[model samples]
Target: MKKARILMVVLFLLGICALLKCTTNTQPPAADGDEKTSRERGEFPDFGAMIPVAQFLKQYPGHKIFKLSQDYPKQLPGEDKIPAFFKMPFDDKSKWMDWLLAARDYCFEGMIDADFVAQDNKKRDWYHMPWLHYGPLASEGFSGLAKEAPISPYQLAPEQKHPGQVYALGFYNDFAGHTLYKMWNTSTDPDPFVTQGPKGGFPEGTVIFKFLYTELDSLDVPYLKNPYTRLAYITPTFKDSTNRIIKTMNLIQMDIMVKDKRADKYGTGWIFGNFCYNGNLNKGKTMKDRVANLVPVGIQFGNDPGYKTNWINPYPVVKTMINDTLKETFINASADLPPQHLGWGGRLDGPVDLNTASCMSCHATGEFPQIAALVPAQAFIGDTLANGSMKYLTQTDAPAWKKYYYNFKCGTAYDPKKATSTDFSLQVSLALEYYWQWKNTLMGGYYSHQYAGIQHMAIRGGIPFKQVKMIKKRGKKQKVDSLTQTQDGF
Candidate 1:
């Protein structure tokens, strides 16, 4: 009996040991809900994604302008809906034709009607022009007019000092300012500047514009009438010695979008500074007469047919064009200067280098206008009652402009002047603007970070429609519209 009891004890101990081994050897489940072994599972999330048009429409109905533009007669008509002139077969009505002729006027009607600025402050009739700020400084008699002369690459003198400073002038504005933004470069390596604070963001500044007019000519729209002779001025915040900051100018374009699949990168629209080839009006080119002569140079981003974009020479981002000679010179010239020492608002590098235009002056980290890198600025050009008046107003009025001007603040409600730094401002600005215009409330703010940071998010392709047919096509099936749900007669 004693030997049998001992044998039972030994058997129980062995069984317990076996159970422990089984529990310890088991492995946790794979991430991404994969059941496959570690070797068979994919390594990372797929970044190469093409957002479908249907999905984009379903996700963002208001952004799907084509549906509204195409079927305007059938849809509800109001201030919120598509304007009749923009409708398909737009010339179908005479009253709408006159309205369509002033489409840009309609787009800006609220601003004119609001008169957010001076009633007499209208120095020039800039509102009537098709494209604003799209010409050279002195192309035509120092006005924003495009010079009859041909445009060539800028011949900048060598920098003799450390961190040179030059102000690009010609473009002007009133109480409110502009905010240009850029997407973080996802291709080469992560931008070291991106972070949680003001200092932690994409570098941005003024980049001079020096492109051949022949290039601009190639970008002409086929059926559309070209507005300006040439694109000459860029907007910047620089002041004269008297302590004025707005008088400063640069020859740079706002809202440049870059898209590259192979680079594993895409660019959000970015704005920068540059030199105007034309001299100032009185001292060089007078501010009033300078931009007034400006005309439509070319369209950078197209809203039709798959959303194609054309920049100078087909090069997307100017940062990518810096060659060895330019890089070598910039590195040597900027060696002694401390990074982020330029302060929150400092913008300028000494004389421009002929070999390369230093785009980083305004674009690299820590520039005040790097507002877009940290937050979206233009998004607010229409957010408030006054700003929205400037944005959507048709008939200009000064009293209205002032009433809405004070409400314009780049920062948050806590502090509109300056609150949270970095991408948050742009995000918040975009949120406030889109929410007010499209959604009309904070609860319904329709801004999306994904689309906000990626300029090409709205570009897409779809099936072609039949010319003579009366049927609405969905996938491979064609059905008569009257027979669809609305005709079900409940």
Candidate 2:
């Protein structure tokens, strides 16, 4: 009897163990060198069923030429060598439109494929590119503008209203990728102010595209039905274990900045363009046709002094949704929208209310330690209001309004002889700011102290500390201030 009881107990225990194993082993085992756990490498419900790039190309024959270019101009003098195919004259509006469409297709190609996985099967989709976010972590924050005000005084802008939910994915062409990698790799390095080395400035043929999306219900406003196509990728944020379909974030805006010496007369050798999605596309029924909905808001090649700054805005009147209500806004449509609630002359904005900044003005603020701030805290007295109300200073010849209007310059409009050039790269300025923030952290402070101690000892032994002048030729040197010096520039 005792032996029988023991055998039965053993059998029961084994059964329990088997049941536990079955329940616990819910996810697939990771392959070797696959540092990502199952949760980190989110499962794709229809893994193999994703639309392949080749198939997509076949379906949309017009996008056949949208492939990565092997040879692109990288430096000065080489700018002139850029092929006619890549160069669109400022006056040629049709050519610019066609080039932009093709460029968008080229950048988004292969975004749906699973083969392009980077960093532990973190699916690299069109929205989640490798070079953009830097890691697997999805951008965090509320879907739209934050309910509360920002903690930093400098962050007091319309764009700063949202902390993280407004996800942005950036892409660099072959010419710019080389430089991007170098800067990104050293992003965590102790020194924060180093903007240049052997590989710093982007090459002449470099092109950067930034796609900005706003989550549904982001603005607590009713969204237009079928405003944009939905993306295949699911949002990692959800209570249910099953994957929920995250609609392709409403395609608010797309920004394109290019480096070409032909634009050197503007000051930064860069041309900036902003495109806003027109939910009411005349011919867009399919996903491919939706690309046509992106109307060119304007292009800033230079911030000329006398003129109101020439630009092209194909659609001046647009239908928009705010706070769940439908509304119509009048844009300059001919020139870039003047500085409104956000972004300069409204060139740097999307559908959302953001900082008062302009594309070229904001980008031109890119510099090490970011000495010069771009956008002023308050709007100009004669500046156009967000509601499309203007004081008509342009017609009155008022000095104050005229002075405010002249501030609109393209990225290349700055005089290098008078001010230091950031080479038309915001990444350079951001890198330095990142370094400063890192050095101020507790761990950063400890590491910095240790390094400083070593340097002090070296100095006693005849080594000298590297010195940099904080002030320019005409002024006294000033102390290095906060790491957040460039926060308001955006």
Candidate 3:
């Protein structure tokens, strides 16, 4: 039988190499009520079936408090300092030629003037615009607009023309297909840990699009393997009396990229990168004339993926799915029965405090002056409160501000079993065993999440209803209806 046809052709090539190693990387489906809220019930503490990775290695046996080192029990003040500005190599152009020549004289000839406003209407005019931010590889003492300017109301001085502030000085490109989306793709095998960028050499900060007539016309221009780029060189130029340059703008460019994983076309997500201007030198086309200024329209799907699928979108896994639904109702009641009594840091029968917004709701980040961004609030750290009051806490209100905000109701919405009189299912099994060991130390562990879409490209920049209010009444004049139908041929 020819040795049984060589053992059935070596078992059909090892079953096509175990179905091509189980169809390479794929994951993104935990968000729809996250596995029925990590189920666990009974024992008055269904704290989402516990499983804090074997009780977080029996309570941090080798404890590693969010990396700073020296093992840390408490160390701040430069905590063993190390920044000569992150040492070197991000593609060192001689150690970033003095910060890219101070980002080209602090973003050469910059001009930024925008006001997204309306947290509650600080004025009303929603989206006025003028943009540019630190270009010419800034460093010359953080580039012009004196009184110290590293961006922030554009640090005044050219006679300080504050006028409702908003003057961002030059350069921050990201425009390719805009942001980026593609989730998955396969050639048959290839993904050893994913790495590509040569044939057309595009991924260096991503940009390559050849759409023209579908199937990419003949299939080309499709690079991008993990490109994250940011460049800003501006000059919003301030002025007065007779000097000049007072907004004599005409040179702005902002290109932000992401769009690259294409699943056929128009699918994956994230996009925002497009702009070009250069003509004003002294006003012939103003409005900061960069080809008659008018760029706006790029930003996609911020909320509505239901589960997930991975294209690298970690905004801290949406605050770990809202602190695992408030640690599954603070461990249902704090388990351990028969001879129980365990109850460690209980008190949150459901008012909110799934570990006080899990790590200050994204660590909120420093500097506050009413935040717009000059420091304070950057990727993690939410619930504010150092006297800035957004209020979030577990205990301690003694000094000036003491974290407080745990209203865990978990079902209609604010649920997290709340945290207070201690014991609430052992503080939600020690806050999901300290957030599944801090989401297994982010990315490097491949849990994934990073490509921030040009900080909200723009569909009005991250809208979740800040104020629509139109309660009706006032003068009531019900029904009239008319203007219907339309053309068929001019």
- In order, candidate lDDTs are 0.22, 0.38, 0.19
Better TM-score candidate (2, 3): 2
Across 328-392, the per-residue lDDT of candidate 1 in tens digits comes to 11111122111111100111121222111122221221211222221111111211122111112
Provide the global lDDT of candidate 3 against the true structure.
0.19
Candidate 1 regions with alpha-carbon error over 4 angstroms = 1-81, 88-103, 110-292, 299-490
In terms of lDDT, the best-performing candidate is: 2
Against the true structure, candidate 1 reaches a TM-score of: 0.20
The C-alpha RMSD of each candidate to the native structure, in angstroms, is 27.1, 16.2, 27.7
TM-score against native, each model? 0.20, 0.49, 0.17
Evaluation by TM-score, superior candidate among 1 and 2? 2
| lDDT of candidate 3 at residue 355, scale 0 to 100 | 21
Which wins on lDDT, candidate 1 or candidate 3?
1
Q: Top TM-score: which candidate number?
A: 2
Ten-residue stretch with the least lDDT total in model 1: 456-465
